[model samples]
Target: MTAADRSARLRGLIAPGLAALVCLAILVGLGVWQLARKGEKEALIARIIERSHAEPPAAPPPFADWDPKADEFRRVRAGGILLHDRETLVHGLAPGEPGRALQGYYVLTPLRREDGTTILINRGFVPTELKDPQSRAAGQVGGETSVTGMLRGSEVRTMFVPESDPARDAWFTREIPAIAAARGLTNVAPYLIEADATPNPGGWPRGGQLRVDLPNNHLQYAFTWFGIAACLVGVFSVFAWRRLHDPMEPGAA
Candidate 1:
């Protein structure tokens, strides 16, 4: 081809070529990010499993010594009087099996320690019908009680999730501060006790609320991003090759 013809062909590719380059960079970057996420997710899952299975301390650590990040999911034993009068229900969805989800609400009740400190215990799941405290009266044991469970931080609600309505006693997430304030509790622990699966008095509020099921599909996500990047490269390569072989009008895209 003549020099002018070659230059025209190269110029014809400028718009589409720059577009493909930008897309390719984004896709490859996403792939790398997902791979890094996979490693971080794996480490987090390991730490959570270890904490969940470890032997608990005699009693929960002092409130002043609490650390949200380092102390989450730590198993501990806490003794206090069950304040059944002040209970909050956080909506929950437990998987009964593959493709089956059992909808319920987690019963959270404040436990009053001898030292006048309070901590909320996620006493666990109860079907919608038994949401009312009177419906599950037997499980609402009064007086002092000891509970073994893992410590957890407050659950955050996303922008898409609805805000907790204290007036109606409706909560979408396990928000500690909101619940404590709504229930008029004082000196409450910063963290919550996710009770272990020890059967309750009437078996209404089941314990063992360990919901640490982190999905590790980052590898698959990385592959998908990389695959799209590869396909883009292949398509651009073929288009550029064809464009280079064929004649193009001057300044055409």
Candidate 2:
């Protein structure tokens, strides 16, 4: 090709070439970000397992020093009188037997401590039929009791989650502030507790509902992003080669 033809072809590629490079940078950045997120998630899981296995403290941390990131998934023992009448059922789906998944609600009852402070304890799952407190009478043991389980932060509602109604007691998300306000609870803890697998009195709402369902798919996502970036490079390479080879082609751009 002549020098003028070469210059014209280079000029034609400038805009589209810059756009492709920008896209490539974004794709590569996403892959790197995902790798970083994978590391964060791994560190979090390891921290949780280690803390969970350790002997739970005699009591949960004081409300004065509540840190969401540090306290997440930490196991702590709480002693209080389980106020069963103020129990809030959060709609959920859980594994019933081995392979069977059943629709149920997580029983979150306020436990009033001797200090007059209250904290929510997710007692565990019960089938749809036992939604009413009257149905699960035996499990409602009223008296001073203590529970050992993982301390959890308030859960955020997603797009798929339904609007929570306090009047109907229909909850889809574990919003601490909202629930406490609705139940007229005072001196409430900033976090809630998911009770361990220790069997309850009537075996109605099973305990140990703590499932670390953190999806570590960042590695897979990184690979996908990188794969897409590589494909884009190949496509741009071919397009450039064709345009430079055939400067007269109308579709080269």
Candidate 3:
């Protein structure tokens, strides 16, 4: 091809080449971001496992010092009277002793601590039939008793999850502040406690059903993005080679 013709052909490829480069860069960046997230998730899983196995602390850190990122999943013991009158049920499901899936509601009661501050304690899951406190009144421990459980933060709701309805007493997730407000409570701790596997008297609200099996799919996502980027490079290389050699094929002017 003539010098001018070759220059024109090269110029035609500029926009497409630049676009491919930008797309590749974005894909690679996403892959790198996922890798970073994988690291953060790994560290989080390690912390959760360690805290789950550790002995319960004498008491949780003061409300003023509560940090979701640092204090979540901590095993703690707090002395208080479970205010069953103000208890609320949150919708949930748990594995039954027979290994069957059991639909239930988590019994969350406000525990009035000795300091007069109130904290929400997740007494644990009760079957759908035992949702009413009256149905399992015997399990409702009154007066003063120490609660031992893991310190947990408010749950993050997804866009698809419906909002909590206090009037209907329907709670899809454990939203601490919202629950406290709905129940007309103040000085409530920012976090909630998942009561340990301690058996209750009535064997109703089965405690210790908390599971920490967080799905770690960041690595898989990272690989997917990286694989796409690699395929893009290979495809682009083939396209570029074909474009460069098109005129050299059998077609002569």
Candidate 4:
């Protein structure tokens, strides 16, 4: 094989080889980004877990004193009568561990605290078959009952979705303010109550099934990206080798 032929083949490989290298670098960069995101997610999960297990804090002043950033997820203890007639059923939630095709609803009612503030309470998830609001008869707690739970800010409405129809007893999202207005509630707390796992009467709206899990698969995603980068490098290497050696055959020369 002539040296000139070999030189020509080497020159032809340079452009494609460089392009492949650039692609490999891009894939590697993406993989690194995903890894960093995974680390961030893990840290966030740790914080949430810590918050969930911490003891409940004292109740803040009122909705007027609520500061979402500083007070979100803050635990508090309060007591009031559950307004059973005004209970709002949040639709689209499924029942049981497997969350199969069975439909269900989240029982939400206003708790009129002693301080004259109304706080929405998510009693618990109930099956759709028990849609009769009266199925769970209103049992008075008699006097003020002490309730402990997490403080969550108001639920926001998503864009492009129709507003919930309370008259029809249908709800898709948890827009607290809207729900409060529909129930003719005044001075409603800025947050809702996620009841603690406590024993309640009749076992209705069984409290304590709040699953606060955050998905953090950033590490796996990062590895996948890195694997793609490695594949890119291998493909480029093969292409480069073929270009450099194919023309070196004696017959071809």
- Judged by TM-score, which candidate is best? 2
Candidate 3's TM-score reads: 0.91
Name the candidate, 1 or 3, with the larger lDDT value. 1
Order candidates by TM-score, high to low.
2, 3, 1, 4
Better of 1 and 4 by TM-score: 1
The residue-by-residue lDDT of candidate 2 on 197-228, one tens digit each, is 98898997899877766689999999999999
Candidate 4, residues 124-197, lDDT tens digits: the string is 76677667766656432445677787777766667955668978867877778889888999988778878777
Off by over 4 Å in 3: 96-100, 248-253
lDDT of 3 by residue, 75-129 (tens): 8899989899999898878986687888889999999988889889998898898
As for candidate 3, its clashing pairs are none
Cα deviation at 195, candidate 2, in Å, is 0.5
Each model's TM-score?
A: 0.90, 0.95, 0.91, 0.73
* Span of 10 residues, lowest total lDDT, candidate 3: 244-253
Each prediction's total of clashing residue pairs, residues at least 3 apart in sequence or on different chains, is 1, 1, 0, 0
lDDT of 1 by residue, 1-253 (tens): 8988888889989999999999999999999999999998898889888988888885554467878778887888999899998999998877577998788899999998999999999999998889889989999877889999988889989998788899998899999999999999999888999999999999979887586788999999999999999999999999899888866553669
Please give the distance, in angstroms, between residue 67's alpha carbon in candidate 4 and its true position after superposition.
Answer: 6.0
Model 3 score (lDDT): 0.86
Candidate 1: 10-residue stretch with minimal lDDT: 243-252
* Candidate 4: worst-modelled 10 consecutive residues by lDDT: 134-143
Regions of model 4 farther than 4 Å from truth: 1-30, 62-71, 92-102, 138-143, 154-167, 212-214, 241-245, 248-253
